[model samples]
Target: ITYRLVKEYNLMINILRAEVVANKAGELIMDIEGSEQDIAEAIDFTAHEGIEFRILKSGITLDEERCVHCGACTSVCPSGALTLRRDDWSLVFAPEKCFACELCVKSCPVRAIVAVMHLNGTVLAG
Candidate 1:
Protein backbone atom coordinates (compact mmCIF):
# COMPACT_ATOMS: atom_id res chain seq x y z
CA ILE A 1 0.00 0.00 0.00
CA THR A 2 2.84 2.39 -0.75
CA TYR A 3 2.17 5.54 -2.74
CA ARG A 4 4.00 8.65 -3.93
CA LEU A 5 2.72 12.05 -5.00
CA VAL A 6 4.51 15.31 -5.73
CA LYS A 7 2.65 18.59 -5.82
CA GLU A 8 3.40 22.22 -5.12
CA TYR A 9 1.28 23.21 -2.13
CA ASN A 10 2.35 26.84 -2.41
CA LEU A 11 0.56 28.34 -5.39
CA MET A 12 -2.97 26.89 -5.21
CA ILE A 13 -3.67 25.76 -1.68
CA ASN A 14 -7.43 26.17 -1.47
CA ILE A 15 -7.47 22.51 -2.49
CA LEU A 16 -4.94 19.72 -2.54
CA ARG A 17 -2.82 19.82 -5.66
CA ALA A 18 -2.10 16.08 -5.40
CA GLU A 19 -3.09 13.01 -3.41
CA VAL A 20 -1.38 9.75 -2.29
CA VAL A 21 -3.39 6.93 -0.86
CA ALA A 22 -2.20 3.87 1.11
CA ASN A 23 -5.01 1.45 1.82
CA LYS A 24 -3.05 -0.82 4.16
CA ALA A 25 -0.04 -0.64 6.46
CA GLY A 26 2.62 1.01 4.30
CA GLU A 27 4.38 4.26 3.54
CA LEU A 28 3.61 7.40 1.51
CA ILE A 29 5.91 9.99 0.06
CA MET A 30 4.50 13.44 -0.57
CA ASP A 31 6.25 16.37 -2.10
CA ILE A 32 4.69 19.66 -1.12
CA GLU A 33 5.59 23.00 0.39
CA GLY A 34 3.66 25.50 2.53
CA SER A 35 3.41 27.05 5.94
CA GLU A 36 2.34 24.93 8.91
CA GLN A 37 -1.16 26.31 8.65
CA ASP A 38 -1.29 25.35 5.02
CA ILE A 39 0.01 21.87 5.72
CA ALA A 40 -2.46 21.37 8.53
CA GLU A 41 -5.32 22.44 6.33
CA ALA A 42 -4.18 20.19 3.54
CA ILE A 43 -3.73 17.20 5.82
CA ASP A 44 -7.26 17.70 7.04
CA PHE A 45 -8.50 17.54 3.49
CA THR A 46 -6.41 14.46 2.85
CA ALA A 47 -7.85 12.75 5.88
CA HIS A 48 -11.35 13.11 4.48
CA GLU A 49 -10.16 11.36 1.33
CA GLY A 50 -9.61 8.18 3.44
CA ILE A 51 -5.87 7.76 2.94
CA GLU A 52 -3.90 6.44 5.92
CA PHE A 53 -0.35 7.73 6.32
CA ARG A 54 2.75 8.00 8.48
CA ILE A 55 5.43 10.71 8.55
CA LEU A 56 9.16 10.09 8.20
CA LYS A 57 11.47 12.85 9.51
CA SER A 58 15.07 13.63 8.63
CA GLY A 59 17.37 16.69 8.61
CA ILE A 60 20.40 18.48 10.09
CA THR A 61 20.64 18.59 13.85
CA LEU A 62 22.80 20.53 16.30
CA ASP A 63 23.93 17.32 17.98
CA GLU A 64 25.51 15.79 14.84
CA GLU A 65 27.57 17.63 12.29
CA ARG A 66 26.77 15.43 9.25
CA CYS A 67 25.16 12.19 8.00
CA VAL A 68 27.50 9.39 7.05
CA HIS A 69 25.49 8.72 3.88
CA CYS A 70 24.59 5.25 5.01
CA GLY A 71 21.63 3.76 3.22
CA ALA A 72 20.21 2.24 6.37
CA CYS A 73 17.04 4.26 6.14
CA THR A 74 16.58 3.29 2.54
CA SER A 75 17.12 -0.41 3.17
CA VAL A 76 14.81 -0.74 6.16
CA CYS A 77 12.05 1.42 4.70
CA PRO A 78 9.04 -0.93 4.59
CA SER A 79 6.81 1.21 2.41
CA GLY A 80 9.42 1.97 -0.26
CA ALA A 81 8.72 5.68 0.17
CA LEU A 82 12.03 6.58 1.76
CA THR A 83 15.02 6.73 -0.56
CA LEU A 84 18.70 7.56 -0.24
CA ARG A 85 20.30 8.99 -3.31
CA ARG A 86 24.02 9.23 -4.08
CA ASP A 87 24.23 12.71 -5.44
CA ASP A 88 27.47 14.32 -6.50
CA TRP A 89 26.74 17.34 -4.35
CA SER A 90 24.94 16.33 -1.15
CA LEU A 91 22.06 14.45 0.45
CA VAL A 92 18.87 16.01 -0.79
CA PHE A 93 15.77 15.67 1.35
CA ALA A 94 12.44 15.63 -0.46
CA PRO A 95 9.90 17.01 1.98
CA GLU A 96 6.95 16.11 -0.16
CA LYS A 97 7.72 12.40 -0.08
CA CYS A 98 9.15 11.95 3.42
CA PHE A 99 6.96 10.23 6.05
CA ALA A 100 9.06 11.48 9.04
CA CYS A 101 9.45 8.12 10.89
CA GLU A 102 12.92 9.29 12.00
CA LEU A 103 14.41 5.86 11.19
CA CYS A 104 17.33 7.52 9.48
CA VAL A 105 18.07 9.38 12.67
CA LYS A 106 17.67 6.32 14.85
CA SER A 107 19.99 4.01 12.88
CA CYS A 108 22.58 6.61 11.97
CA PRO A 109 25.98 5.56 13.29
CA VAL A 110 26.52 9.22 13.93
CA ARG A 111 23.91 11.45 15.52
CA ALA A 112 23.48 13.87 12.59
CA ILE A 113 19.72 13.67 12.14
CA VAL A 114 18.04 16.85 13.30
CA ALA A 115 14.32 17.50 13.18
CA VAL A 116 13.38 20.68 11.37
CA MET A 117 10.72 22.39 13.42
CA HIS A 118 8.74 25.21 11.89
CA LEU A 119 7.63 28.35 13.69
CA ASN A 120 4.04 27.12 13.58
CA GLY A 121 5.28 23.97 15.35
CA THR A 122 5.40 21.89 12.15
CA VAL A 123 8.66 20.01 11.77
CA LEU A 124 10.54 19.75 8.47
CA ALA A 125 14.02 19.10 7.16
CA GLY A 126 16.34 21.84 8.35
Candidate 2:
Protein backbone atom coordinates (compact mmCIF):
# COMPACT_ATOMS: atom_id res chain seq x y z
CA ILE A 1 0.00 0.00 0.00
CA THR A 2 2.91 2.31 -0.60
CA TYR A 3 2.53 5.13 -3.15
CA ARG A 4 5.62 6.74 -4.63
CA LEU A 5 5.34 10.01 -6.48
CA VAL A 6 8.00 11.43 -8.75
CA LYS A 7 9.52 14.80 -7.79
CA GLU A 8 9.36 17.90 -9.95
CA TYR A 9 6.64 16.28 -11.95
CA ASN A 10 3.00 15.31 -11.78
CA LEU A 11 3.80 11.62 -12.08
CA MET A 12 2.48 9.28 -9.44
CA ILE A 13 3.60 5.68 -9.07
CA ASN A 14 1.31 3.27 -7.27
CA ILE A 15 1.74 -0.26 -6.04
CA LEU A 16 -1.72 -1.72 -5.61
CA ARG A 17 -0.67 -4.62 -3.37
CA ALA A 18 2.48 -6.39 -2.25
CA GLU A 19 3.58 -8.99 0.31
CA VAL A 20 6.72 -7.87 2.12
CA VAL A 21 7.17 -10.74 4.55
CA ALA A 22 5.82 -14.08 5.64
CA ASN A 23 6.88 -16.76 8.13
CA LYS A 24 5.64 -19.71 6.04
CA ALA A 25 7.28 -20.60 2.76
CA GLY A 26 4.77 -19.65 0.10
CA GLU A 27 4.20 -17.26 -2.74
CA LEU A 28 3.51 -13.64 -1.74
CA ILE A 29 0.86 -11.61 -3.49
CA MET A 30 1.29 -7.98 -4.49
CA ASP A 31 -0.86 -5.61 -6.49
CA ILE A 32 0.96 -3.11 -8.62
CA GLU A 33 -0.88 -0.46 -10.61
CA GLY A 34 1.78 1.24 -12.67
CA SER A 35 3.87 0.74 -15.76
CA GLU A 36 4.75 -2.89 -16.34
CA GLN A 37 8.43 -2.04 -16.61
CA ASP A 38 8.46 -0.10 -13.36
CA ILE A 39 6.57 -2.85 -11.61
CA ALA A 40 9.04 -5.41 -12.85
CA GLU A 41 11.94 -3.26 -11.65
CA ALA A 42 10.44 -2.76 -8.22
CA ILE A 43 9.67 -6.43 -7.80
CA ASP A 44 13.17 -7.27 -8.91
CA PHE A 45 14.68 -4.79 -6.48
CA THR A 46 14.32 -7.29 -3.71
CA ALA A 47 14.91 -11.02 -3.60
CA HIS A 48 12.52 -11.69 -0.79
CA GLU A 49 12.03 -15.23 0.44
CA GLY A 50 8.75 -16.84 -0.57
CA ILE A 51 7.76 -13.64 -2.32
CA GLU A 52 6.48 -13.65 -5.88
CA PHE A 53 4.45 -11.10 -7.77
CA ARG A 54 1.68 -12.08 -10.14
CA ILE A 55 -0.03 -9.39 -12.13
CA LEU A 56 -3.73 -9.82 -11.60
CA LYS A 57 -6.00 -9.16 -14.53
CA SER A 58 -9.60 -8.73 -13.49
CA GLY A 59 -9.13 -9.77 -9.86
CA ILE A 60 -11.54 -11.70 -7.60
CA THR A 61 -15.28 -11.07 -7.87
CA LEU A 62 -18.07 -11.89 -5.39
CA ASP A 63 -21.36 -13.52 -6.42
CA GLU A 64 -24.28 -13.38 -4.02
CA GLU A 65 -27.68 -14.33 -5.48
CA ARG A 66 -26.20 -17.13 -7.52
CA CYS A 67 -24.50 -18.52 -4.43
CA VAL A 68 -27.44 -20.68 -3.28
CA HIS A 69 -26.76 -23.90 -1.37
CA CYS A 70 -23.05 -23.45 -1.70
CA GLY A 71 -20.82 -23.47 1.40
CA ALA A 72 -17.74 -22.65 -0.60
CA CYS A 73 -17.34 -19.34 1.14
CA THR A 74 -17.09 -21.01 4.51
CA SER A 75 -14.49 -23.48 3.34
CA VAL A 76 -12.54 -21.01 1.24
CA CYS A 77 -12.61 -18.20 3.77
CA PRO A 78 -9.30 -17.98 5.58
CA SER A 79 -10.75 -15.73 8.29
CA GLY A 80 -13.78 -17.94 9.01
CA ALA A 81 -16.01 -14.91 8.81
CA LEU A 82 -18.20 -15.86 5.85
CA THR A 83 -20.28 -18.83 6.85
CA LEU A 84 -23.16 -20.78 5.30
CA ARG A 85 -25.96 -22.99 6.62
CA ARG A 86 -28.96 -24.83 5.18
CA ASP A 87 -31.40 -23.56 7.83
CA ASP A 88 -29.81 -20.12 7.87
CA TRP A 89 -31.42 -16.94 6.49
CA SER A 90 -29.40 -14.03 5.22
CA LEU A 91 -25.68 -14.00 4.64
CA VAL A 92 -23.92 -12.91 7.76
CA PHE A 93 -20.97 -10.69 7.03
CA ALA A 94 -18.63 -10.13 9.95
CA PRO A 95 -16.80 -6.83 9.81
CA GLU A 96 -14.11 -8.03 12.19
CA LYS A 97 -12.62 -10.53 9.71
CA CYS A 98 -12.94 -8.03 6.92
CA PHE A 99 -9.55 -6.41 6.50
CA ALA A 100 -11.06 -4.09 3.86
CA CYS A 101 -9.19 -6.05 1.23
CA GLU A 102 -12.41 -6.20 -0.86
CA LEU A 103 -11.91 -9.88 -1.67
CA CYS A 104 -15.39 -10.86 -0.60
CA VAL A 105 -16.80 -7.88 -2.36
CA LYS A 106 -15.23 -9.02 -5.57
CA SER A 107 -16.12 -12.66 -4.95
CA CYS A 108 -19.79 -11.87 -5.26
CA PRO A 109 -20.82 -12.46 -8.84
CA VAL A 110 -24.33 -11.10 -8.44
CA ARG A 111 -22.93 -7.87 -7.01
CA ALA A 112 -25.12 -8.29 -3.93
CA ILE A 113 -22.23 -7.41 -1.65
CA VAL A 114 -21.51 -3.75 -1.24
CA ALA A 115 -19.38 -1.56 0.98
CA VAL A 116 -21.19 1.45 2.33
CA MET A 117 -19.42 4.42 3.85
CA HIS A 118 -20.98 6.77 6.38
CA LEU A 119 -19.63 10.29 6.26
CA ASN A 120 -21.12 13.45 7.78
CA GLY A 121 -24.45 11.79 8.35
CA THR A 122 -24.53 10.62 4.78
CA VAL A 123 -24.06 7.12 3.43
CA LEU A 124 -21.67 6.83 0.51
CA ALA A 125 -20.90 3.87 -1.70
CA GLY A 126 -17.42 2.44 -1.36
Tell me the spans in candidate 1 whose CA falls farther than 4 Å from its real position: 1-65, 78-82, 86-90, 119-126
Total backbone collisions, model 1: 14
For candidate 2, the clash count comes to 13
Q: State how far residue 3 of model 2 sits from its true place (Å).
A: 17
Off by over 4 Å in 2: 1-78, 86-91
Q: Please give, for residues 21-43, the per-residue lDDT of candidate 2 as tens digits.
A: 56654433333345656655655
Worst 10 residues of 1 by lDDT: 1-10
Candidate 2, after superposition: displacement of residue 83 in Å? 1.3
What TM-score, computed on C-alpha atoms, does each candidate reach? 0.36, 0.35
Error of 1 at 84 (Å): 3.6
Alpha carbon lDDT of each predicted model: 0.50, 0.48
- Per-residue lDDT, model 1, residue 64, is 25
Per-residue lDDT over 3-118 for candidate 1, one digit per residue giving the tens place of the 0 to 100 score? 22225334232222345365644344544555777566566656766765444433434242466566565665454544555565334455555555566667666666655644
Global lDDT for candidate 1? 0.50
